[model samples]
Target: MLPISYSSLNNSRVNRDGSSRYRRFIPEYFRRIFHYPQMDIEYTFWIMFYLCFNPSRVYKITYWHKQTKNQWARDDPAFVAICVFFMAIASMSYAIAFHYLSFFHIIKTIFWAVCVDFISLGLVVATVGWWVTNKFLRVSAHNHSVDQNVEWLYAFDIHCNSFFPLFIILYVIQFFLLPILLSSSFLSTFLSNSLYFIAFVYYYYITFLGYNALPFLQHTVAFLYPIILIFTFYVLGVVLNINFTISIMRFYFGQ
Candidate 1:
């Protein structure tokens, strides 16, 4: 018999249908979470940069990942970790910029922003995406012995990828425009809500791209349907003179 190489061993772990075994995947993912040195910060940053400028290229990488790794989801946690780090920093900056006096309030702001907004909401969105795709979008395995399902971790990865752009637009870019966005004028309200509109539309677009990249998935355009609802709300927000950015700030820091 020939020697068992590491590559063969790794390939053997993937199911014949090309889905990853979460039994092995979960522990490995979480284990790597604390191993900072092993994380590829450069690659993660590259993903974030392209996600903002050329998001389709980023999903192309996901396709390449499936070709090489036999799975559509990322095995690395570096992207998720870096995203949470950025979220925490943005939350802290907002707390300080808003002149939050109490340390408890500052910590609470960070907690809500990072834990609730990013992590909790991410989990919910990811779960829904995972279930919806697997239930309705996946190809039937009538001929094949086994069916492929969209991995939950991969769904969460898409959320992280999509959320990064939203975070940059709302948390980082919007922060710099606080002076104007916080003003009590129609122009300010329109601009601020427009920022939210753009951010959410980009989020859903990236999400659609992510699901579309999966060869086992069909009808991925359904992911973009939310944009229509978002646009309708944007029009309503503009008509109502609501500043989404200011409202979010008020919710966060009571400003």
Candidate 2:
């Protein structure tokens, strides 16, 4: 059965569709994380249209199927907002612990990496915030008229169409060109890029497929991501001796 929040919207069996790769084991997480915006717009309010023909009791069931299904549903914006709130709190805690407390000896290199990460995340939040605020501030009966075509309703359409291609081009330039430019021009190594990319792909794989490795792989990855940065910087420090500090500062600043 559907949750009460979505039941009124005419949801179907959560597992009726069989095409999802995670259907057999972890449908819930995959559904919640990846399904919502797409289903909300394109389907007939039929949540399970992507799954099996016959629906099961997604809310009441407590076994693997229901657990996974619930995990998926939690990706809805309603739940994500709560998760992000906690994540914000955690980020603040990290700042307090690393920047304020005189506890662990956070290498100067990792400290700068965290700053870069915070700045990037800050810009994402700011730009999205401005766009959303401006969008609503400009709303008018004529602009958002119910009678108008959706194409006209969402003038952001053309921008969306171009976003992916632009991202691809920039990524190609960054991935292929940035390294060459940085290595040859700036005389820097790509250590941070490599470590973070591993963490990213690992996180995505786990989010999509879950861990299929030995019992410790999940735990290892969970702990290794941050430690990887620390360890990488430590190695550089050992290799470069006294020059490591200056080089790392330059890399972080130039980045």
Candidate 3:
């Protein structure tokens, strides 16, 4: 049975397709989080989505989620879809605003950018998960017979849920803030970098909560470990940017 908040959304009417007649988005999302908070993966996802739009409340969400005793490993597909949609919107905005790129070129650029961004972020997540599991997570004495591979997967799941807000904000800056400030070189770079730094610091705090929440992994000094991973992602992004620039030069200018 659904909770009162969820079940009452459509006045208790089932739709023709066997779905709820009413689609309660933000309200039910908030309701679930307020009621269940920690044990509900759906609540966690709803909280992530809320933070994506209202970034200032990230700290509160992180604190609340940390109090729950339940563990979650599944990825949120809805958040991914929202992010990809934003990426497409950003790409379309760039294409229309720039006007020099053809439709084919714009499509190609969007595809490549989205692929690289998603894959690079995934790599960072996987790397952090592996590192955390290897270095911090201890094996349960009760599960000594379990294979070692499961530990890393669990870490990945935790990382994904914890870092999702940061992921969404990064894209928001790239796709939304980048275009608006593209006209001014110095101002754009300064503002965008400032926003990114602020977002990263905030995200680091949230991740610290996740670290504390996990039963198998808890350390005071290692709280700053996420910053190192963030720097690694920055270095990877810089290298990719350099390679992309060289490829563009070679293709266009025959250099």
lDDT of 3 by residue, 1-255 (tens): 855776566644556334432334343433333443333456545666655565445444433443462223332334444455566766556555456368786786577546655445655765775686556564454555532322343444444444556555554445465444443354544554445555676666655654554445446346567677766654554444333222332453243
Which stretches in model 1 have alpha-carbon errors above 4 Å?
Answer: 1-26, 142-146
TM-score of each: 0.88, 0.22, 0.51
Q: Quantify all predictions' global Cα lDDT against the true fold.
A: 0.90, 0.33, 0.50
Candidate 2 global lDDT? 0.33
Candidates sorted by TM-score, descending order?
1, 3, 2
For 1-255, candidate 2 gives per-residue lDDT tens digits of: 955766644444444443453566764533555555533333222322211221222212213432475221222332322223333444344334334344342344334333343334434533543344334322334454432111221112112221212222222233344334345222333443443343333333332122111111223234224456655655664455423323433443433
Each candidate: how many clashes? 0, 14, 0
lDDT of 2 at 64: 49
lDDT of 1 at 128: 99
Which of the numbered candidates is closest to the native, going by highest lDDT?
Answer: 1
RMSD of each: 7.2, 19.7, 10.8
Off by over 4 Å in 3: 1-45, 50-71, 139-164, 167-170, 173-180, 183-189, 220-223, 226-255
